[model samples]
Target: MFAVVLLAHGDVVRERKIAAHVMKGSVEIRSNHRELRARLREAGSVRDTAVEGIVERLDPLGPVCTGVIDGGVAFGVRVTVPYVILGPIPRETFETLDWPR
Candidate 1:
């Protein structure tokens, strides 16, 4: 999921270009043998052409405890949030419901 976000955010923009080249036209290989190689080479070199503001390192995140009842990834598009604890249980609702004779 994180990878999907990164791909959409111009992180792997060149990869999208490369894929287009590989699948140009309807079942057609638009590029000649040399040209296809060149396109691939260009795609591989996109990162080399850019320097500023690129993510230098993607340090792995998590196994950190999420503070909500379901704050992390779960099965099949579901998220698991952590349970929240409310301090000092309130008794006002119970008291109001009781009628005094």
Candidate 2:
């Protein structure tokens, strides 16, 4: 199973909505930062400080941030499997029950 960590600049409701949209194929996987921020703000107020903090924490983890916003609507989404802590593992490992390289 793949775990997806979705970070957004809004409340939990907004985050979940975006996650659902992403999962349902309604929202494109690669969305512009501006668009995302706008959508997030629709749910609630988004703080720049909070967005920056999340970005700083997730950037090292190889999470990709959309670059369509003016450094305001920054966030990340990380998909990984549970129980593995070494980093992103191979899909084949999970399928075959083999050790991840």
lDDT, candidate 1, at 63 = 18
TM-score of structure candidate 2: 0.24
Residue range 10-89, candidate 2, lDDT tens digits: 22223333554344432543445457556656634344444455556545454334221222221333232112122343
Please, what are the lDDT tens digits per residue for candidate 1 over residues 16-82? 2334533334122333545554664574356333321132321222111113233332221123322
Model 1 clashing residue pairs (backbone): 68-81, 68-82, 69-81, 69-82, 69-83, 70-80, 70-81, 70-82, 71-80, 71-81
Candidate 1 accuracy as TM-score: 0.26
Off by over 4 Å in 1: 1-5, 8-22, 26-31, 48-53, 56-101
Best model per TM-score:
1
> In the order shown, what is each candidate's alpha-carbon RMSD?
17.1, 13.8
